[model samples]
Target: MPPATPDAALTSATASPQQAAPDAQGGVVLAPVAETPPKRPRAPARERTIGTKVAGQPAFVLHSYPYKETSLIIDLFTRDFGRVALIAKGAKRPHSQLRGVLQTFQPLSSSWVGKSELRTLTDAEWVGGMLPLEKTALLCGFYLNELLVKLLARDDAHPALFDHYVSTLNQLAHNEPATIVLRKFERALLKETGVAADLGRCTSTRAPVQADVTYVVDPERGPRPERASDPWPRVAGKTLLDMEREDYQDAATQSQSKQLMRFLVAHHLNGAPLNTRQILVDLSQL
Candidate 1:
């Protein structure tokens, strides 16, 4: 303490800087220091996009809806890409090049772009089909669309199902019995979606279904015994076998096959009704 250094004095002076000043009430007062504002981080740049062609892709229009004033939002079922959404700019115009090309139940080759789930449709060219669906078949075609919409996930390809759908449409267009064609398609749809069980064997026992035995068709499961308590339709093993072969020619097979498919489809639909089916029923009633 005899000769305090200048460094020690300066340190002692600044150490109690707050206490150095006092208000009238004897409360310590602190001086404000200038603060540098925090710098904000910059945003990341967006990825650059380039369009490419999807050549010779087989596709069909599942459904289309109006968009804006001059465009349409088309849901396409492609051979290799499953269900896809495409924006058809200017498709609503009176003379749009794609106006006549984008139609349901008709085969098509479509081109589009964009990496996002919803793509832009650049072109659509119709490939002539077996024929256009009419009468009861028209409503049945919509039923197929509804099934695809409800069951199939977007952009998941099923080439075999796509082929089956085309063949089903052709059968309907050619006036193959409505019920038979529908049953075949429904079976194919369920099988392709991985929901259908083995038609030949019992779920409980590994035994093959005998042609004479009466069995109960379980929707979630496969065929089993027709128990005394359960109220579901009891189908013959022969009927099930006929369905497996897609042979609906026999009168008995056709009648029973309809009931079987309807039961199976209703089970998977979870009580949500198909309105197109009701239309077909009503027309048949007339």
Candidate 2:
């Protein structure tokens, strides 16, 4: 077309770059820009999972603590589920049904829901064992509880360890010697958790522990000869062999086994004293 006015050209150039249509009033209209939708937040992962029946499983309450005003959080070691935490709602009430059934070391048929680290305990029915642990045995039972609480991780199942625990409790309840039963359980716990040292063989010589020889228990590496400078206890080869066979009945084996396990457990515990040990020591003198 012929030369346009400066104002008209400027208006055409500055207008939006989209093709415009005529309005009712014969004015050019620009299309409206679309607004973007806002983003939504993601939901957290569900803790519960679907599963089949866990009915009639053998289990025991390892320990428990007050959760709030009327509830308690129980740590259980079940035959199938291993170590799991359960919230026993209203378990703290004076007449709560669960109050009588959830005592430690008593066998129970426990039902819980969810695959969460903390499961909700649905039901608990007591299954009595031999008899209640009393005197020294009771303290030993608490010592076992403390070990499990410190070493075992939540929701991690160890069926063999569970069985061993049940057996240990039964032994303790039957008035078995505290030192013997505790040593057996401690060794089993260590083995089940994959921290047990080789008791039958020498680390350097790769030979069976001989009854005539004296050896040092290396907590990290197993049994070896006592070095000229090492301060750990030197155990007899017979003691190592006895430990390997779980034979604490022999007098010599019992004595050396205690010293060996003490060295090994203390090494793993890194000088952190077990309160139960001190309690036992105090009670023995009285």
Candidate 3:
């Protein structure tokens, strides 16, 4: 028989070496070899990392408040990073570069670095293509910023919603109907956060909604036939479908969708009041 390879011989047995007696002619006798333990591999060394750094990202200042004596705590809405709280060191100082650069409603290219929930702002510069929001549009911009600060969680990326927000701002700046703009933004926010339901379908029937039927939207579920005891807003099926298509030209669609969206937003907020909403409501605006 062919001899076992050296590896096979070593692996096939774990017994101690046995001493063999000399042959009749007294030839040199070979002893069985004991198995040796396999060596363990050495682990690779870990790299020393300090923190994360993001640069030249699209962003906007949602809100800011004075921090310490010369710094500011800023709530920033970023295209890729969502809502982030940043400490803008020396931002409140009269001659600080960031003092003039960190205005709200302006597009910015920003850089930040940190490992914690709140980050350090490294640099920011205005992108400067968008027209400034003025008059009621300025208030509306603040309202949008408020919604983002309240609804979105830190470090959650919502690139699509961010784009929609820019578009909404542009529309509002150009004097488009504020009602339509606010409704669209509210719907997008709810849908992006997984809080919105399909308005064209009935939750109970598993079928398309009838345009003439009156329904109440369940916050956790979708739309269902209205009950007399239900406390939710009653919306006509046509209004729901119109909102689904984003067509608010009809007066009834406009009025009913306003109430429906308000109810849905309030439900998702869990009784938390929106300050900007109250201000607009007091002014008889959206």
Candidate 4:
């Protein structure tokens, strides 16, 4: 079934990565600064497998909207189940426990049930500890949620991506730079979705990428060196190499990587615009 509302269509709420920097041309290069914090402990009450009834499955409320006069429909990203839609029954009441818990950005251990397309959120608890994002970091955090809602399919599991997400969120909560964090997450997202071309080797020649060449990442063909003012978005080979190492210290690399990613993402999205992306663009800080 389709979502009760468009993914995050009704979030009239305020919310909340990386060693990042402001893009000289208006973008962000968020890469990991330090190791990701430890993973949240698995909810002990969770069933051994992902089934109709989930108990304390580690999850995040990606986005939510009022479902009715007294309930809410939420899109959740679960550790095992990927993007799952759950109805937070009666969560709209001012006194409801779920009201405070079903919030974006914060981590939670959630319980839910139902074999249908949409499930029911039975329980949620805050997995507190990390600092909340402020100012720019908070917007970047919402941008992450937007990407997940748009790119990932429901019920598909990518444990690696999920772990990266947890790490990304933790980094966002801290003083780490933001550009590197977003870039790393964007790369991970593309990789998980199977659309990102490899950065390690040239696609056409299968030659290992060198640190000194200039290359353009072919969305279909992989990274190829720049040629005579190459048309496709361009980045230095060192930048690609640095990105492969998950590093974004070089200014040229940060600027170029941001452009390369935007082009590839736009191509893959087939002209479907990302609203958050546009907001970032308008604010000149993606």
User: CA lDDT of each candidate?
Assistant: 0.83, 0.81, 0.90, 0.84
lDDT (Cα, tens digit) per residue for candidate 4, span 7-99 = 465452321225677778989876645666899768554344455587878898889988989999999998888999999989989999988
Whichever of 1 and 2 has more lDDT, that candidate is 1
**Best candidate according to lDDT:** 3
- The digit string of per-residue lDDT tens for model 2 on 167-265 reads 888898898788888888889888887889788999888888798888898888788888889888878888888889988788888877877777777
- Each model's TM-score, in the order given? 0.78, 0.77, 0.84, 0.79
Candidate ranking (lDDT, best to worst): 3, 4, 1, 2
Ranked by TM-score, top first: 3, 4, 1, 2
Candidate 1, lDDT over the whole model = 0.83
TM-score of decoy 4: 0.79
TM-score of model number 2 = 0.77
For residues 1-286, write the lDDT of model 3, one tens digit per residue.
9999988888767557666768779976868766789997754331112247788889999999999999999999998778888999999888999999999999999988888888999999999999999888888889999889888888788999999999999999999998889999999999999999999999998899999999999988999999999998899999999999999999999999999999988888878888888888877778
Weakest lDDT window of 10 consecutive positions for candidate 1:
44-53
Poorly placed runs, candidate 3 (over 4 Å):
1-51
Superior by TM-score: candidate 2 or candidate 4: 4
Looking at candidate 4, the ten consecutive residues that score lowest on lDDT are 9-18
